[model samples]
Target: MIETHSSSLKTDQMFINLGPQHPSTHGVLRLGITLDGEVIVKAEPDVGYLHRGTEKLCEVRGYHHCVVVTDRWDYVSAMTNNLVFCLAAEKLMGLEIPARANYLRVAMCELNRIASHLLFFGTYGIDIGAFTPFLHAFREREMVLDLFEMVCGARMTYNYIRLGGVMADAPPGWADKTSEFLKYFKTKLREYDDLLSFNPIFLDRTKKVGIITAEQALDWGLSGPNLRGSGVSYDVRKTFPYSIYDKLDFKVCVGEAGSCWDRYYVRMREMAESVKIVEQCLAALPSGDIMAKGVAKIPTPLPGEAYAHVEGARGDLGIYLVSDGTSCPYRLHVRAPSYINLAILQEALVGLRVADMIAVLGSIDIVLGEVDR
Candidate 1:
C-alpha cells in the first residue's frame, strides 16, 4: 500500500553550487542551490568553513583577554564587537562606566558602523558590476579607519574597547579630523546615489528581483537593513538604548520597497544618521577618565548568565556569558547577525535569477568571518 515513483517524478530543476570560492560571494560561503532554469528554487547554505571554535577559545582565556578573539568575528565592526562583550561583562559585574567613557564608546561604535556600511556599499556595488562605488566607499572607509588608528593604534583588528571603558582617550584634534571626514562622507553619499542608486541598469538589476516581504522577513528573524527594507522600523539602538543611545537623537531609516534598492537605500540613509550621532558625541564629548576603576583586574561577577547586544552595523551583535565566580567565563555565546541573516537566503533566493541571487546576497552584506565563527 505504498506509492512509488521513479526518475520520471523528478523535476528538471538542477542544483548549482555557488562558492566556497566565487567572486561575488565575498568570502568562503557555499550555497547548494537548486535552480529551475535561471530561477533559484532552493538554497542550502553550507557554512563552518571558517569556524575556529571561538566560543571555546574564549572560555580558556581570561575575561579581559578575549577581546582579540571577538575582533575576528566581525572585523569590520570590531569596536562594536568588543563593546558587546565588554558590556555583557560590565553588566554582570555591576560596573558603571563614566559619562565620558559612555559617550566615547558611542562615538567609536558609530564610526565603526559607518565604516562597516561603507564596506557593504563597496562590495554590493562590486557584485552588481559597478566598480566605482567600491573605490569611493573604500576611500571614505579609510578616513574612519585613520581616525580609529589614531585613537587605538590598531586598524582592522582593533581591540580598542575594553571592560568598564575604552583602552584610551581620544587624542586631541581627533574630533576635528573626524568632523572633517563626516562632511566628506555626506558628499560621497550623494555622489554614490548619482553614480549607481538610480541607474537604469542598477535599478533593472535589483528592483522586483530577490524580493522578500515584510511578513516573511519577520518570520525568518531578519534584522538591520534586511528587515528595514521590508518597512520594519525596529532598531536595536532605539529598542535597547544602551551606552547613552537614549541621549542621542537619530532617525531609523526604513524602506518600503522590499527589494535590493530599498536595502541599499536603508543602509545609505543609516550612514547619514550615524553621522548625526557622531557629530553629537563629538560636540558634547566630556573630558575625563577613559578607563574605569576596578577594570585592570579580571572581573568575576556572581554566578549567573547575562545577555548584552548592540546595534552593530550589520544587525544585533549579542554576547551571552555565564559566570561561575571565576576570572574565566563558564560559557560564552555570540549571536552573530550575519549568520542569522544568511539563514534566510534560501527563502530570499527561491524565485530569483542567478545574478539577482548574488545581488541579494551582497545586499544582505554578510561577513563570512562572523557567519562561520
Candidate 2:
C-alpha cells in the first residue's frame, strides 16, 4: 500500500469576507479580500451599506433645515459638520458673525474633535484585543458628552452651530466646567500613554505594520491624522484658516514614521493640542450678541456658488453650494474626508496577515456613515 500511492494536490487562492457585520469594521463596511495562506493577496472595500442619499436630501431642504441634515454625515463630530455647512451658507450670503459667536464656535468644534478622537482611541483598543483601554477611553469620552449635552441638549448629533452664529451662547459657568474637563483630561492622557502607548504588545503589533509612504498618502487623498502620520504637515485649519483658528495658537501634530503606530500617535498628540486651543478660546471669549440680526431671514444669494471647508476630526470637511436665487439649494455636494481617506484601504492591506489587516483597518478610523453618504 505504501508503494502504490500516487495522488495530486491542489492549491488555490482563498477569498474571505471581512465585513458588513464584523465588530472591528466600526460600521457597516465590507471588505472582499483574497488571501494566499495567511497573507493578504488583495483587498477590495465594498461601501454604500449605509448610504441615505444625504446630498440629494440636502437639496430638498431649506438652507437652515440643511444644517440638521449635515449632522448625520459625521455623526460623531456633528459640530464640525455644522460648522462647515454654516460657513458655506454664510459665505454665500455675505454675512459676518459676531466675534463672541466665532470664539464659541471654535470652542465647541475643538471639544467635538476631542470626543471623536476618544471614540477612535477606545474602539481602536478593542480592535487590538485590549478591552481595558476601551473602558478608560469611554470614561473620559462621557465627560465630553456631558459638556456637549449641556451646550446643545444633544449628545451625538447637536445641531448647535447655525449660519451667522451659534444657536445660543454658552450658558453660565460653562467655561469653568470646560476648564475642569481639560485639566482632568490632561492627566487622563498621561495615564493612557503609560497604559497602552508604550506597552510592548501594542508596539509589537503596530510599530512597523501597515506603513504608508508620504507620497502614497498624498496620492491616495489621505488627510487628517492619517496623512500627517505619513509625515505630511497639511491641515485644513493651518493651510486654510477658517473662523477664529488663525488667531488661536496651537501646533499641528505630525508623526515621524508612516506606520500604524504613527497614525495612532498623531491623534493622541492632537487631543492635547485641541485642549490648548479650547483653553485659549475660553480665555479670549468676548461678550456680544450670539447671532447676527436678520440672519434667520437671510435670502438666497445672487445666482452663485461657494465652497467652505473646516478641519474636521477626520480631515477636510467641505460643502459646495449652488444657488439659483432660490430658498432651497439648486445643487449641493459634500466633500467628506472619511470617504476620501478610506479609499487607500485596498492598497494598504496588500501583503499583510489577517490579524495585521484588522490592525491596519482600525488605524484608519473610518465611520461608514460619512463614507457611504
Candidate 3:
C-alpha cells in the first residue's frame, strides 16, 4: 500500500468459481480459480459433482449387467467403456470371443471414437468463440449415431459390447452405409481445417497459449490425444494390442509443441486414422458367430482377479474385476482416463491468463461423468 509496483496499485489475488453452471467450463465442472489480476495464479478443479458410485454398484450387480453400468461412466465413448469391462470379465471367465465378434468390437469402438472426437471438435470450436464449426461437426456426428442405432437400437448409452461378444451382429446393409459415410467424412477433414484449425484467429488463440511439455504430460498421467499431443505416443490399441487392433493398420498421430492447438489437432488427426481402421475392418470383416457360445445366463467366475484396458476416446480406460466364485463381483474398480487426465488441470492452469483457462481446459476434453465416477 505504501509503494506501488508501477504506475498502478498492486493487485490482490481474487478467487472465483468458473463453473457448475458456466458454459465454457464444459459439463458441470467447477474450477476454483485464483486470479492475480488477469493472470491465473492457481486453478483447482472441483469434481464429484456428478458422481454415480458406478464401481460400487458393479459389485452388487451380475457380471453381465455391469456392462450396461459401465456405459454411463463415459457416455461419450460408451463402446470403449463397454469393451473394457467385457474384456476384464471375459478374462476372469477365460472365454474365447469369436473372430467376428472381436472384429465387430474393434469396428464399433473405432466408430465410437470418431463420434466422441466429433463432439469435442464441435464444442471446442464453440469454447473458443467460433460458432460455425459446431454446426458442421454435429451434422456428421448424427450420421455416426444413425449407424449405431442401426445395429444396437440405442444411440448414446449403447450396451452393445458385452460379456462374451457384441449384443448382436450388424444387420443387412449396415456395412455399406458405413462405407458411404467414411468416403464422405474423409473430405470433411480438410473442410474443418478451413473452418477452425487454420483460421488465423484460431491459431493465435490456441497456439503457444497452453503449452504442456512432454515431461509435464507424463508426470500428470495423461493419455489418448492429451498424451499424444505432448508427443508421448502411448495408445493402448497400439501398445497393448487389445481386441483386433493388431490386425488393423493405422498411425499414431502426435504433436510437436504440446500447445492447445496440438491437443486439438491430435484428436482431429486421430479421426482420420479411425476412418482408416473402419475401412480396413469393413474390408476384412470376418465370418463367424457374433456372440461366443457356452457363456451361461448367470454364470459364476473363479476366485481371481482380472484387469483390462482400452485406448478410449478420452484416454486409457481400464476396469479391474474381482470374483469370489459368484455371479456377483467381489470388488470392482475403474481406472477411468477422464478421471486421471483431469488431475493435470490443477497444475497446468497455473501461470496463464484467466481467459486461456477455458482454452486449455477445452483442449484436454474432460467428460464430467467419467471424472466423477
lDDT for each residue of candidate 2 in 1-373, tens digit (9 for 90 to 100): 4665344434478999987999999999999999987889899999999999988997777899999999999999999999999999888889899999999999999999999999999898889989899999999999999998888899988999998899977889899999999999999999999988888999999999999999999999999999999999999999999998899899999997889999999999999999999999999999999998787564677789999999999998889999898888888899989999888988999999999999999999888889988
* Angstrom error at residue 108, model 1: 0.9
Window of ten residues with lowest summed lDDT in model 1: 292-301
Q: What is the C-alpha RMSD of each candidate to the true structure, in Å?
A: 4.2, 2.2, 1.5
lDDT of 3 by residue, 1-373 (tens): 5954684677788999998988886789999999999889888899999998988898889988888899999899899999999999999999999999998889899999999999999999999999999999999999999999999999999999988989999999999999999999999998999999999999999999888999999999999999999888889988999888887889999998999999999999999999999999999998989988999899699999999999999999988889999999999999989889889988888999987888999999989999998
In candidate 3 the C-alpha lDDT for residue 57 amounts to: 91
lDDT scores for all predictions?
0.89, 0.91, 0.92
The estimated TM-scores of all candidates read: 0.96, 0.97, 0.98
- Model 3, position 239, has a per-residue lDDT of 94
After superposition, which runs of candidate 2 have C-alpha atoms over 4 Å from their true positions? 1-10
What are the runs in model 1 whose C-alpha is more than 4 Å off? 1-11
Superposition error at 278 for model 3 (Å): 0.4
- Of 1 and 3, which scores higher on TM-score? 3
What's model 3's lDDT at 278? 94
Worst 10 residues of 2 by lDDT: 1-10
Candidate number achieving the greatest TM-score relative to the actual structure: 3
Count of steric clashes across candidates, in order:
0, 0, 0
TM-score computed on alpha carbons, candidate 2: 0.97
